[model samples]
Target: CATGSAAVRQGIRAIDANAARIVLVVGAEQMTTTSGPEIGKNLLKASYLPEEGDTPAGFAGVFGQIAQAYFQRYGDQSDALAMIAAKNHRNGVDNPYAQMRKDFGYEFCRHESEKNPFVAGPLKRTDCSLVSDGAAALVLADTATALKMRRAVAFRANEHVQDFLPMSKRDILAFEGCEQAWNQALNKAGVTLDDLSFVETHDCFTIAELIEYEAMGLAKPGEGAKLALDGETAKDGRLPVNPSGGLKAKGHPIGATGVSMHVLSAMQLVGEAGGIQVPGAKLGGIFNMGGAAVANYVSILDRIR
Candidate 1:
């Protein structure tokens, strides 16, 4: 489930320990081949089955509940969520690998129509990530070996944090695990959020991206909506985010998402990202989570060669 980032972590550890000079990390998922009902059932297995097994919309239902709680405390964020979807969709248009590259405007995403009906809680279909099948791979090597390569993106920091699985055991909307992972990674990298040129975060759903804005210290809690509304996360804004469309449009091939995020960030760092490249990107941040923030991973990357 969390194997995407976990694989990267283990690969780095192996190299760090001098056990391996280079490690190949691969993540692939073939989710679209299955029937819809079976897909839902399989995804449900990622949840705390004892309590969330019967959730109506599978993982979407769980995130929907989180969205509902957030709205209750922060007022309705439908507009902000819609803006995020629209923004990501627009970004996806430039992503050659995106699953859905068509831009659906904010109005279409904000208002629920037959095409974007409510799937769970107040989350419309537009607010959810697509079921995608994709594969992404990375080759990690020691610093000396990496420097000799034509282009290299060095990991300044990488951190992983795990939290309780059951929603009852923790505050579902807080995303404490995500916050912790980001904090630890930044601290280890000896940098602050402002040092990042861009970020590629997990947007399993639009709400997840909204909350992640806060979890990553971009904004205060309950006020993450302002970042999107103010255009701070736009590709040309203060700090560009998800220039790759994130999971919202780039696709959430569950097993491959985390590695995909890292690959995209690395692309930006090395100036290899074509259409989705953030201008003058020197440092990049990446956050990838699994199971409603249960498994949190953060990485900071900078081009060394």
Candidate 2:
């Protein structure tokens, strides 16, 4: 997940030190080949819950619990979560590489039906990212060499932040590590959230996007729901988030997730995103996380050529 971006950032730094002229980074995953129950069991390994425990829902279950806790602390925001899901699904319609490009409208996403069932507590099937198989790659070169290249996207700032792995060790609602990574990247890049043209954020679950809105300084804690309800993260909104449909619609192939974010963000910045391009996009931001926001990575990128 977050390792894809972190590794690319390190490669870029190594190139700057003259370790190499060109660096190629690739990430891929194949999760759909496995059986559903086995996949669920394997993903549960990432959770702090003991493997032998009575809990059986896997990561979806863990995130659903987080959603429940958030609901308890703030207020029921099922509508807001639904809005995020619908928005991303709609956005995926324009993304050619998206795994689930079909447009599932708000009504379909908001309410549970025979087609859209509950996966775990509070979280519906629409709220979860799909099991997918995908890969993405990037070629990074020195500034001088990149100048001669056909296209150039420079990393303005890339930051990584780590938090406690155990869910019990920290506040599940805060996503403090995500906030810290965004702050550090923005500061290092000498820009604010408003400076970016668009963003491709990790939306492993719709609730994650809701929490990320607050973590990225778009809204105060407990107010992120308002952003989605008001359509702020919509494609035509003030600042489009996850214009590539995010992990929810675009697909979450584990290792490929972060790389996919970078690839799509770069496409937007260079006007190569085709139907999904954010008009006149010049700068793009990407946020990818591993585990439950334990490993966080943020990269601010700008078109240079």
Candidate 3:
């Protein structure tokens, strides 16, 4: 932590001093079976070089721990994440662009069958995100250049925020960085939560989507869980969320997630989305996080073109 922090601090200072216009930060993680294990080995190598056996478990194998702490602290009901999965699956069933198009119910996920296995304590094979190899890009243009491009999708607002590295260091119930990013995006979009007809967030796990309601200010602090239970986040709900099937069902392509979020949201606005289209979506939100909420990016997009 000390070493990495020092480098980041130095980088930020240099950029600020040089009058850099913008910074497009992305986390492109494409760890295959061999790569996943290798990353685990690398984390262990970096931290416990002298004592290899004492290193932390595989980094890819840690979402469950975060989910466990999340549900424990946030107070979830009936693994509400299942509803999020359902939403994504149903959406994917129609998304020709989606990685997973088959629809699976919560019943099967709750009761582990031949396929689904428990990854972390409470997170199941079906509950976790998929290791998809994909890419997403963001064209961060200055206000004038972005407006002049005319051929490009303008990133009206690209806000970045951060949280504690370790889950124990911050509140697991809600994403503080998400809230900050949300505020910045909405402000840049010149709208409020109500103005957005739909949203796309990093549903790496169902729990992340639940907290997004609060972070995005779509739901009250702890009441965001009800959005899932009440069908409010459904495709035709009052405020639909993750209409693109999300990382859980659509597949989590780390490098491409942020850009994908914008692309999916843009589809909704333009009415090009095959089956996951929202009725009259004009404004949308795309929220992406890296490394268990370590870094956050919130983008607000509209159909001005």
Candidate 4:
């Protein structure tokens, strides 16, 4: 999952250096073999040592804490988070490859119930991504090689930016690394956010998506919630995000999530996405993050074949 974007970068480098005409990038994760608690414990290892593991809620707890902090700083946006979850779930219904395809409406996602109880802090069950078992792969080639192929998508810009590892070392809500990656990638591509017709972003948690709105300049900090509430990130909105339902609905199979995002975004650019297709999609953006935004990768892609 974390290496997915980096793997693509390596592939691009390999082709650019003339070391290889093509490169195969793949990622897989088999997470369902373990119980939910066990998975939570494993995910907790991603956080800072000692304290994170001791937290009763595991990964969700960490993100839940982030959500709480954001709310405290900028009003409660649980409604916005629910809207994000509902939007992704609704989009997921059109994705046959998605793990959870059911469209759990906004009401079910927003309010807590016996089935949709809070996992940690304000983060409800629907706010978290699924523990999925899956694999995704892609083939990358040089421009010359791709031009000869029947179908091909080119990477307009691929940039990566890393932040401090410890959550306490930096402002968790700012996601500065994420913001930098987006700005650098777009600048390198000679385009702006509006040039992208759609995007496939890392939504390991619904809160991540909300904050990413601000990180990617879609909204000002502390106001990302308004983007969801106003439906700016909806499928038919100005810049449709996660048209494939995102990790929220498509399932976040650690290793596969990044690869799946690129695949879905490329599909949209090429008109190969049957159900979740965004008409007239010429440019696509992909953001994949690892470890609480510590490692961020952004890719701008467009179909050339």
What tens digits encode model 3's per-residue C-alpha lDDT throughout 259-282?
677767877777787688888777
How many collisions per candidate?
A: 0, 0, 2, 2
* TM-score against truth, every candidate: 0.98, 0.97, 0.78, 0.98
What tens-digit string does per-residue lDDT give for candidate 1 at 1-305? Answer: 46799999999999989999999999999998899989889888878999999999898898899999999999999999999999999999999999999999899999989999999999999999999999999999999999999999999999999999998999888899999999999999999999999999988889999999999999999999999999899898898889998899989998899889889889888888999999889999999998989999999999999
**What pairs collide in candidate 3?**
135-256, 136-256
**How high a TM-score does candidate 2 get?**
0.97
TM-score of 4: 0.98
Best by lDDT: 1
Clashing pairs in 1: none
Q: Candidate 1: where is the Cα deviation over 4 Å?
A: none
The most accurate candidate by TM-score is 1
Model 3 deviation from the true structure expressed as Cα RMSD, one decimal place: 5.3
112-169: candidate 4 lDDT, tens digit per residue: 9999999988999999999999989999988988999898999999999988878888
Show pairs that collide, candidate 2.
Answer: none
Q: Between 3 and 4, whose lDDT is larger?
A: 4
lDDT of 3: 0.67
Quick one: how many clashes does candidate 4 have?
2
Q: Give RMSD to native, each candidate.
A: 0.8, 1.4, 5.3, 1.0
